[model samples]
Target: MAATPNIYGILAEFETPADAMHAAEKVRDTGFRKWDVFTPYPVHGMDKAMGLKNSKVGWFSFIGGVTGYTSGMVMIWWMNAVDYPIPIGGKPMFSPFGAFPPCYELTILLGAFGALFGMLFMNRLPRLHHPLLKHRRFALATHDRYFIVIETTDPKYSENETRKLLESVGSKRIELVEE
Candidate 1:
């Protein structure tokens, strides 16, 4: 059989956050969509440079909160009034007012769950492996280096053109990361 192709992407290393940020902006402007930047620390303008939009995790939390509140209210009403109708201490079988506290608690509970799970799912967490993890020099991402990866999967990706683009953006080191 022919040799298997193992290319994953082009990984560009920059000497500083500013270089990475500038490279990100150039990548974004060049219409390459499926790329990412990794830095040892959060870079202030990286999100803007990458043209990333705000995350939708809050929407997931909101939906979970609403569902939890509605479910709590309905459960209370059903158990106290419709199902058992137990009157206690001259109180009404189902007091909408009394249900508010539990509903609020459940709302908070599920909202927390939603936010946690939403973030995990959105970020594709619990990942066991990534191609970048195998790159010999990529470990510096957690310490002192910044990286920009132009994925081969991106629509505009061309190996030679991407290498040239990375060089044009002042990347001092560029490597072809393999899957």
Candidate 2:
């Protein structure tokens, strides 16, 4: 007999955001790390229910802004003081005031880039497809449904136990999603 196909995860459909939020809380309490909740609209407190922490994207933007500002200052200092120094009206070759505008512009530019790239990296985005996207019922998630998916790769995942947990949390339908 052919072996069963690899499973991506267990998908549990829920009828309401409250139901999905409660399911997420239960799953979080169960200590399953590789799981997510989906809903048609943003649900307040879902992040707390999912046990998520504050995002690190701000750090990325801060680092990028610092780098940009430093580079801008260094470039201005080098160009004015070292590359082709010309004493004009006894003015300083490099002035922070003179560099401030360009440095600020660069900081904003690089900070925006950092936020964009960090979000993409953190989300693992630019993907052409996902197995969940192919699941027939998953399309309803954008319309009027809520979903909770626990990945098979999660250390706490056990087919029978996970299914039971989801059922206990009031999932309307439960199915295994194949990889």
Candidate 2 colliding pairs: none
Winner by TM-score: 2
How high is the CA lDDT of each candidate model? 0.94, 0.94
- How many clashes show up in model 1? 0
Query: Counting only residues 3 or more apart in sequence or on different chains, how many pairs clash (N, Cα, C under 3 Å) in candidate 2?
Result: 0
Clashing pairs in 1: none
* Model 2 poorest ten-residue lDDT run: 85-94
Tens digit per residue, CA lDDT, model 2, 36-151: 99898899999999999999999889998998999999999999999988887999998999899999999998999889998898999999989899899999999999999999
Which parts of model 2 are misplaced by more than 4 Å?
1-3, 86-89
Across 82-168, the per-residue lDDT of candidate 1 in tens digits comes to: 998987999988887999999999999999999999999999997999999999999999999999998999999999999999999
Can you give the lDDT of residue 176 in candidate 1? Answer: 93
Instruction: Indicate the residue-level lDDT of 115 in model 1.
Output: 96
